[model samples]
Target chain A: MRMNLKGQKKIINIETSQYPNWKICLINELKNLNSNNVEIDCNDIDLSCTDILELISIADQYNCKIISFCSRSIKTIVSSQSLGYKSQFIIKKPSDNTLKMNEKNITFSKSHFHQGTLRSGEYLDSPGDLLILGDVNPGAKVSAEGNIIIWGRLLGIAHAGSKGNSQARISALHLRPVQLRIAKKVARGPKEKPQLGIAEQARIDSDEIIISPLDAT
Target chain B: MATDTRVILICSGKGGVGKTTLTANLGISLARQGLSTAVLDADFGLRNLDLLLGLENRIVYTAQEVLEEECRLDQALVKHKKESNLSLLPAGNPRMLDWLKPDDMKRIVDMLKEQFDYVLIDCPAGVEDGFKNAMAASQEAIVVTNPEVSAVRDADRVIGLLNTNAIKPVQLVLNRVRPRMMANQEMLSIADVTDILALPLLGLVLEDEQVIVSTNRGEPLTLNSVNSPAAKCYLNIAKRLQGEDIPLINPAEESSGFGAKFRRLMQTKIF
Candidate 1:
């Protein structure tokens, strides 16, 4: 009889201030670990520019992909992303005046607001929801774990419920995306004329994501 | 120093979009108006700007030689025979591309801008490191695209890159436009291209066979005296670039294919 067993994950609880230039210690520790999946606990760790850079470099060195982050500082979460790590860092509230990173238990009020046009080749990824005030031009991308709302037209690619919430929806003032994704379902923009609408919303209905005009009533 | 030199990059995301052709003719046109213009080919391995301007055989030194300190900056400049004010900065062979850094490109462009009124960098096709090098010192950009949907799509991608890189005042130049096809509703109109790219139209070039003739002769159509249709288009583009109020040429009837001309002849009973 085969039994269902769970694989173990390595968690690094770092409060890097204990050592000078804590990145060296972090890299050393990461190098010693055999697992490629790492859960970084950045509790009370001051994630300065260099610190985040080092973290990303060390993570890359070990071919380690961040599974999750435990952080209280919101800036650290943003820093992690800015440093080119797409791993969602969960905010465990503020600890020692520093925001941190996390997991399946918490989504951390996942919502991001951005202003201005997202040009082609530019990518924006959020842990929760994403709201863009300007157009998402072609070749650009916006991905979020929750719903994505674009105040302007959506000409680029957008992925909602990227972390696999089938109910995630994508809404826009003018929807004509190159591609759209909701959870596991993928849909290409129609080859025919786009459905004219003032506003449109795409949500998972039954097993498939459906795009329809928002009800005025 | 004169009003902060303009280093404009002529880029097309897709190849064969007439980037080299535009660079050569526009540089000559600007020179004809008594403005010192230098066209630099930054396409690295693949380059043809010199051939277009009839200055290929006159290349004594290239950018590679300059970078290697084998020649001075002025030594690599190939002066146009007809237009002494215009010059060509030939690109290095593809082998030297590995040594060309972004900062190196910017430094060379800055140096060229100091001596010329208009420094036009002809970028390589595709948005690769070569493209980045060409864009390093450019303050303005002209995205060239054909009227075809595929070319328009690629041009849109280049425009996005320019915007993200903070290249201000990006202007679009619609090239090889066959208005006959537009009349048949088979090709995208200037309006359609601009609407999708959302950029200011700088100029339009009618698809003319003379363009090929001038290119093969190693002479810019703008410099030719054959009443070349594409020549007028390039001259107007140059005037617009120099802040002249030259009206944009209406390329509608000029783009009419052979059938329209034959039909006109039949209507006039001259066929």
Candidate 2:
């Protein structure tokens, strides 16, 4: 099925073999299309991977822009490149990239640039290691499944091992936050003026988030 | 030249930190001081500022209505019956979040700035779309927290966001502080909270049951002068925001009296 809006055409193709919901596949296909001007309604059809790949191929053939895809099966979409999606598709793990590491989980460590200061109510969720060069200002939040390293002063809310990895940790040059969460437990910081001049790290210690000075030893 | 309206945002990333209560009382306090004040509830999904202030029944229209162009902005504003200078722009119905666009919010804030001396926005909990909407327009912020670790942690997160966003003059309001708990080393102290947050302290509110009662009654705690310690703190916060040189009242002293509370807090070694 396909729909066109305001000069932007959305061609939605679906296959209902693996999944029962065609609407979900249609939504995913539309998202992979990547055109903001187009609107799609896929309430009636079920979708398959072949159908999605075909849609992407068609989009490429027609040079049509795919805007956004909202899907319930985030893991499936992330693992398979069959969606032919682009533009920082924050996914758990892309199956195409799976050839590199199967024994240990690979941590992606690249700084994500947020143009303006993070305001209250903004949150960043990443799967691998996160390096925020900017300050973690108050009210902003950063959470990761792996370790979180902040080069700037950490003031906002941060969570490491959001996926229940107790070994994950959070580190910052200046660590002072409203709250710090590791795995499931939450902890607040050095209840007094943090003695500056030393780097700090926080990790879960027996179900409690403990903040201690980084050791040079 | 027109005076720039003071935009004070009451924000805390942690939920149930009395942010809405603080916004309502601070608005009432400022209005009682003869300044025209308006409290804007930015908590889109769950708006309780109207109920907390006992203005829920009087709400004829809401900011959502204004945003949808269903009514004029003036029509959505509900005036406080007792205080002529105090008014509220309540959050719209459940679907209010959908209609809340950033530019429309900015327009509403700009319009409020033109009419009121102070515009206090009660920010929603968490760092998400709702919070971004509230902080986008504010010039200053007040992070509200309790004397608990979780609340403090959330406040820290909020402060970081404000700093990153370049929201100037961010201050801290330490709410629901129990002096007895702090004295017993069961809860965090004022110095401990300030040290971790590293922001200037604006006011420290004591844990008073009267605050909850007043909220339940839909009357501002400031109106319950006899039993509300939180009211005094809110009043002082208002004065401080207005650039008044009011002395900071020590929470320990109010709870345990000056000498005993000081001695007990000193024993905690919170310096």
Candidate 3:
């Protein structure tokens, strides 16, 4: 735990590799803290809303208040935010292997894979690339720091390069999304129906988002 | 006689999509086939399954009393007047909504399971606490949706929630299907809906005026108007629920056939 210059608040890092049980490790760490107000840095660990609530209650037993939360996991950040917590989304940097692969002009990152249809009001976020095997229904959204590849239709909103990497692209078997966003650019989906059986891809070209048939890359 | 009672939740996230209608009709159709069915109205705020089954005036004790131990399970269960095999369990007053937990719902369903072969829960609209409470006790679900974009979208959201909750074998029932509109490409086709929701099509209910009439009369169409197109559809859905191998009616062929026209003419005149 590190003390900030502001108040007597402490910052605690809950690493997944530190203990077999993250919750137990966190509790043990909280017990050793000298400060009552604490900020938790949940590095690369996913915590649901209930899990966050349980953690807060556990801290309460030790007379410690969780002032804020920071996580590298988008799920954890989203859950914490939904629970009215001040959370920070630490953007995951490209791994060493990805940087090494960049020398060969092949930039790659670990892709998140989802298998079911994302229905309305559902939102999916991936720190790296995002791959979905089902359709993204209208009113739903999927965003990624890297590229997004959908094996099914894209009827919802999709944002690639969410962290401002404009090189990212979004492709789908049927690319008729409600809206498409690439880095800083945004564009409404085409009104006319796309030809059947043709896969499409959307990307930024000349500072504007453009949709076209998936070309052989 | 409650051997392997199937607790099915009939739900549609959007309101006015025929979740209660399907539950009432399915309960009656199942009862007519000699299987004892009990439909529990989980929509405590707007409970109307009793009215649809014409058991509104007969309800004295509700599931609330049963849970509170003020009355026996049979006392709360209002058996249908015409169909002795079917029964309706009305929910308590709206005040019960504040205190009724998912555990309470499961307890009520467990009690119903002991005496009936089928326990169909008429789920409330929206995926709020009420819907969650109703969904808690259900082993499987029948997601009802109309042939409209908004209804299908809501149904999709509900299906996604159901899948996350590990509710298996969740089937789909396309309600209020306008065959003519579907053929004219003015309405969402069966394929358009199924392609999005991605659930097994259990049955389809064609839009018919008799449904409104039957509903207003506090009598479901399957009770006395089995000849009505919508009633036949409800009966077919009931049969399909019992694992009968009945092929789904093709709406395109149904709307175009001369025999269907004659049947429609006769239904309007004779009934």
Docking class of 2: incorrect
| Shift in Å, residue A134, candidate 2 | 12
Candidate 2 regions exceeding 4 Å error are A1-217, B257-271
Please give the range of 10 consecutive residues that has the lowest summed lDDT in model 2 chain B: B262-271
Per residue, candidate 1 scores C-alpha lDDT tens digits across A1-217 of 0111126567776655555655766776676777777777676455765777667678887898776665656777667766665545564554543323343224655678999888667799999889999888877899999999999889889999999988889999888899999999999875665566578888878887677886641
For model 1, what is the alpha-carbon lDDT of residue B264?
Answer: 43
- By DockQ, the candidates rank as 3, 1, 2
Reference-based lDDT, each prediction: 0.81, 0.75, 0.90
Every candidate's CA RMSD: 16.4, 18.7, 16.5
Which 10-residue window of candidate 3 chain B scores lowest in summed lDDT?
B91-100
DockQ in order? 0.22, 0.06, 0.52
Candidates in order, TM-scores: namely 0.73, 0.58, 0.77
What is the i-RMS of every prediction?
2.1, 4.9, 0.9
Best by the TM-score measure: 3
Better of 2 and 3 by TM-score: 3
Q: Taking the tens digit of each residue's C-alpha lDDT, what string does model 2 give over B216-269?
A: 889988855653456778888888988898888765565676765565456346
